[model samples]
Target chain A: MKLKEEIINKLQARGVELSDIAEVAYHLQKPYSKDLKLEDCLVAVKHVLEKREVQYTVLTGIALDILVEEEKVEGALAKIIREDEPLYGVDESLALAIANIYGSVGFTSFGYLDKDKMGIMKELDTTKEQVNTFLDDLVAGVASAASAKIAHQNKNKELDEAEIS
Target chain B: MKLKEEIINKLQARGVELSDIAEVAYHLQKPYSKDLKLEDCLVAVKHVLEKREVQYTVLTGIALDILVEEEKVEGALAKIIREDEPLYGVDESLALAIANIYGSVGFTSFGYLDKDKMGIMKELDTTKEQVNTFLDDLVAGVASAASAKIAHQNKNKELDEAEIS
Candidate 1:
């Protein structure tokens, strides 16, 4: 069987770049630590991306978005997705399902990130080039997972400092 | 149309009490402000319950959980749900989707509450009276939404205080 990393890499080769996902991680953690590196965020983002469920969410949402961009899918579904109906929230539902894979931390972070639309997310929402139905939540997942990862790692450091002092 | 509070009261008649829901709200806001009341949290919880999507999620999840408890749903899906399969994270997905109505704050709070199982959540999970398959996430959504609500409210309060100074 192919390794999980190899699987994620193949998916990245398709369209979703790991770097774009990593950029969100950079934004989420930069406020806390100036020394934060993209690689650090990439590690956490990749960890979440490696999950089978996340992979499925990423591919499905992007494919639909791509089809909408190309004007392939037609009729009611396309209209809803393209317009992003306020009440018809299944689009957000699918994206949130992907975000939930990382744990509850993904939920609230996904909410704020969705609202604020920062970094690559900012680009995704603003870009006239493509319909990014899944990109925002996918990016939010990466950012939330990375934030949880950093918080978990820092928790121990904080405990150690407390003991020393 | 029935008022939102009335619709919520109907749900309460089904065994899930508003007071129990409000208790979760209290827990969520208490961390931020000791002076926060159960009524304030109830207002926030009620606001979330007003959403059509949130209402649907709560009802569907609880119904399924109840069906399983009564052995009405006898099949593979029942087995999976009753067992809460490791890979079958959709249950949490539906629950988290409800939580997402508020935003990112729900994510982490839901995670912690799901793990720790404190307050009313603890009772629901451990109850022998009925299977609470969905209550965990539902309650978490209540608490998380309330947390996000208080956080949002507090943000404005903080700004007001800053201006006052």
Candidate 2:
């Protein structure tokens, strides 16, 4: 399968659908965009996923989570990751890379999703059966980037209208 | 020349030295590491420069700055970039990609350096003659990643000491 498909499959296996992430993105952009549709958010999420950096981050995080599940990771790092330790910042850092591609709005959106644990992010965070240390943040990253993309599009539309006037 | 050397040369041509970036990194880490040396920071900066993502970001940002200087970029985007508009968040977003590799500490450090605009970052930000719309944030990103590298090392050292006890 293609890398994007592979990533999607991986997320699906982890109980996260792209639509779930899109819902979060819609939530973030709704206030800013009066007529925004959920479909627009879904398209933005897919566009964000097409990025190589985002794909690599998702694969890497998922692979690590799998390793933890298999008990392959060693020592202190393993324990920290398995427990999703509050202070272990690497997971969030990896996710930040995804959001960073969009803009400052991306960062702010990510910060909010991360802290608020909205939608699928909250579900991932509360799940104890599997290690989701990185997946939770990755979900937030995608949602944040998608939201930023919609915001940028909205801004460009306004600029275009202004120029026409 | 290799990709690494090519990136270094590009920065040198743009009037930024690795040591200048190292100074910012050292400043960020000094409060935490009593024995942190400037050389250590320099080494960390070099290490960050070695990453493909960082190298690509630096080259891309510099290339755009050069394009703006040569009057190649068109329309409102060009004007926004040339003026270094405060609301143009893409520059900082690109830089955040470089910092995201390290961890959450890297994000915080990048935020601080971007805001304070110290050392070479300050010089790049204030140079009215040149379009440094992206270079300033790139500098902050490098310094932040280097600082985070040192911080991670220090944390590992503490963990080792604790385990030994």
Candidate 3:
């Protein structure tokens, strides 16, 4: 498997979503990786996922599940799940959740990606329209998550080096 | 037509997904509004759908559209549009995208609803598995979007009142 996919699978196996993994992958791919490690990235992802600031993704997910159980929205989410709606609309939220892990800077980066559709998404050229908006959010979530992750990693790394001294 | 159905048809007519409307409905009924007017709710719904914060949903939807066009995620999101798959995993990014709108609070609420499976989602029991994780993300997106919608409405109302003054 490709490195990105490998990372994605590893995270997913740990209960992280593909989008979150992709967000981390994208962030790690930047020059920042020169100063970070895989463990750092893992911690960053964990921090954002559990942080209070960006918990809306988890909250919304729960609510949607409830709606589905109640057979609300013509069982729309259920229908989407049951019939597997071809052009699903949930990708944007997934992407944003990852980005929100970082911070507002992540939001800025997300805006750029959504407008640009850089990398793999642009190549897809699918009729699905929410790509820019949702991807922007996803990128932001990833960035936010990474920001916290990076900070935590730096703190721990510094402490570790000090201890080694 | 039932209130929920009416909302669903309106969303479908506008090319919005049933889940999207269902999500809006979820917020429309809860803490956000004790006696929410359909028209007012519609306004809030449109606000979120049109707001840049909610763009993540749009972007994910578009990606799934592309994936469906290319035949990826065969049993999940891609199939939902084609009306073929029995169950489709929602694109992870989409859910996150929506959650980012309301920050982490909304995302957490989504998770709670998904895990509990209360309200409209109860109808989905016979049709599919519990889908706690996926639903959590979806609910986060919806709630975040709804929060943004509510925020926008409050802002607009404030602006209108200010103008009258």
Candidate 4:
């Protein structure tokens, strides 16, 4: 299945807004790429998930369910999660393996943003009334990984220019 | 008093290692022109701290204390904490602050070393002991900031060269 379609199905299963799925996927995908736009990264994530034969929808649904149950994805997302919600754990590392194809930098960014920027935390924080303590570390990870990516990109650019000259 | 000396004293009083004091200060100081050596940054930080009258040592010391008390410092340093502890909470950020004076690339090396190179975390993990989580962020921050400093220094150098030429 197409990654986007897969993500959509997963979100649909999880009772997340059809609109929220794209935004969530985009957040998950963005810190991983500097060369790619947010949409491209999202699309790429979808691609990698499919290539790996991942049940992306199932995995994402489970993750969302856990987040909701644990009050990590509270408010609107929580309201949607039903007793019939799938039973599974999100092997985020597996999902990240798909992103690592882009680079470790992407993986780190994914981890960071996942922890910090997903807005689910904010949603969870206000609605579930839980603290987003994990967010700061996640932000730091993204930043640290991004720094590596930035340096690597700069070095690669230097090499490319050198070759061109 | 010179900023370097002030910072060093504060750090020592706060229980920072003598070895790390100057490097931390170097990382925290303003950019030096062209020179990328630790010494150059140390000198620059000392100079700037003096000029600005900023008590960087005190500031850094407090930050270190917070991170340490939070159990954020890890890896080799964490091992050091378990044995022959020079002090607690003198972390990657302090080290990076020292590096930041030199350039951005310098901190990359530190972060790279902190993650892949440091063997302490593996051992600590196996032992089920808490390794410093904050260290990695500090290292990353130092590298990121240093990269910024290097860019700034490069710009200044180019301007100076252009003016002279």
Candidate 5:
């Protein structure tokens, strides 16, 4: 399958609902523009997912989770990857690293989502399901990137896609 | 002096100009609004400077720089903080941590500034007069935070200073 589809499928397996993620997109975009719809948020997020950085982060996060679960990586690193020790933020940093592709705004968004535990994020944190130490911020990065993309695109009424680069 | 001025003063001591930092702010907000003024960017940055997180980062970046300059912090960390070692991103993480206060938008702004090396950022990168190992991303964080602050404020005409919380 395509990278974006694989990324989404991995997230879905971990319980991240696209609609709920779109809700996050809506929250971010609604503050700036009233015309933004949930669909717009989804479109923006999908576009952000295409960025190589975003794809790398998705795969990295998933791989890290698997490594931790199988006890393949351990010791100090395992403690951080598995338990997500509050002070040892390697996981959060790694997840935010993906978000970093979009910008500092993703830092803020990831910080907020990590703090607020909103929507599906709350579920992903403590389900009897798979370990998702990275899912929360990973999703936050996606939504934040999507939000930035939408804002950038809407900046000009007549500016063509070429201008965005 | 007031907290904002104090933060600026601290950054200034590190060789970052208020004008140069404001240039970073302007680059971030200009795309969103044609009405953005340098003074507006300054005001927004000043407000961001008020945050305890931002204050802490300003001081921390300075401290790290001093540590590097004096050869006070060595080992792997010193390599990362002192030279901003290409892949050793601990320093960048410190800067982005400050940007986290604003939102994902700040991440986007920081990423852009880091990538583009525009305006004062270009100058800050190499002015043999001072050691600026951590200066680049720190400046980006400041600019990005300032940018996010402006965007958050402009989202609603009626959003009072009281509502910023």
Candidate 6:
């Protein structure tokens, strides 16, 4: 399978539906856009998944989670990751790369989702059986990037309309 | 030449010195680490440069700046970039990718430097004769990533010392 497909499959296996993430994006952007559709948010999510940085981040985060689960990760670092240690910021750091592609609005939106723990993020965070240290943040990253993409599109649309007027 | 060497050369041609960036890194990290040396900051800056994401960001940003200067970019987008419009968040977005590799602290540090516009950032921002919309943020990104790297190292060192005790 292609990298994007593989990432999608991996996310699916983790019980995260793209639609759920899209809903988060829709929630974030609906306040700013009156005519926004859920389908538009879903499209934005798909675009975020297509990015090379997002693919790499999802792959890397999932691989690390697996390593922690398999008891392959060694020593102090492993414990930190396994516990989802609050100060161990590497997971969020990786997720930020995904949001960073969208711009400042995307970056801040990721921060919001990360803190608020909305939608799939809440489920991912509360599930103690699995090491979701990275997955939760990655979901937020995708949602925020999609939201930011929509915001940029909306801005452009306004500009075009203004020009026409 | 290697991609890294080419990037360095490109940066040099644009009047950005690695040492100057390292100094920014040193200043950011010094408050947190009493024993930190400028050389250590330089080493961290070098390591940040070695990242594929950072390298790609620097290359892409510089290429866009060149495109803008050459008048190859079209229409409203060109005007936005040429003027370094405050709301043109794409440059900072690209820069954030560089800092995201380090972790949350590095990411926040990049935000700080970006807002404050210290050191070479000031030079790059104010020299209006040339287009440096992206270069300023790129430099800040490099410095912040290096600072975050040192912070991580310091944390590990503290852990080690505690274990030894």
True contacts kept of each: 0.03, 0.21, 0.19, 0.00, 0.02, 0.19
lDDT of 4 by residue, A1-165 (tens): 444465455444434443333354445544544564445433433444343223322332244334445544322223323231122111232334333444676565556555465544345324433222222222222233333444455579889999999
Model 2 misplaced regions, further than 4 Å: A1-87, A90-165
Q: What is the C-alpha lDDT profile of model 1 across A1-165, one tens digit per residue?
A: 545665466446434577877887777667766677889888878787777786677667667777887799989888767765433455556656766554544554565576567767787777666677666666676677766676556656776999999
First chain of model 4: TM-score? 0.40
Off by over 4 Å in 3: A1-157, B1-35, B51-93, B99-105, B128-140, B151-165
Worst 10 residues of 3 chain B by lDDT: B125-134
Better of 1 and 6 by DockQ: 6
Error of 5 at A53 (Å): 1.9
Worst 10 residues of 6 chain A by lDDT: A107-116
Sorted by lDDT (best first), the order is 2, 6, 5, 1, 3, 4
Question: Better model by lDDT, 4 or 5?
Answer: 5
lDDT of 5 by residue, A1-165 (tens): 988899888878777767778888788668777888999888877777788777887889888887788889958887666776533455566667665565544554565566557677777787745667777767877776677667666754435755766
Q: How much does candidate 2 score in TM-score?
A: 0.57
Which candidate should be chosen as best, given lDDT against the real structure? 2
- lDDT of residue A79 for candidate 4: 36
Model 1 share of native interface contacts: 0.03
Off by over 4 Å in 6: A1-87, A90-103, A106-165
Lowest summed lDDT window (length 10), candidate 3 chain A = A127-136
Question: A1-165, model 2: which lDDT tens digit per residue?
Answer: 899999999999999999999999999889879999999999999999999999999999999999999999999999999987644888878888898677685775676566567788888989888999999989988988898888888888888999999
lDDT of 1 by residue, B112-165 (tens): 566556667787777777667776778777667766777778767876999999
DockQ of each: 0.05, 0.13, 0.12, 0.01, 0.04, 0.13
TM-score of chain B of each: 0.84, 0.97, 0.48, 0.37, 0.85, 0.97
* lDDT agreement with native, every candidate: 0.69, 0.86, 0.46, 0.40, 0.72, 0.84
How high is each candidate's interface RMSD, in Å?
8.5, 5.0, 12.4, 18.9, 11.3, 4.7
TM-score for predicted model 5 compared with the true structure: 0.51
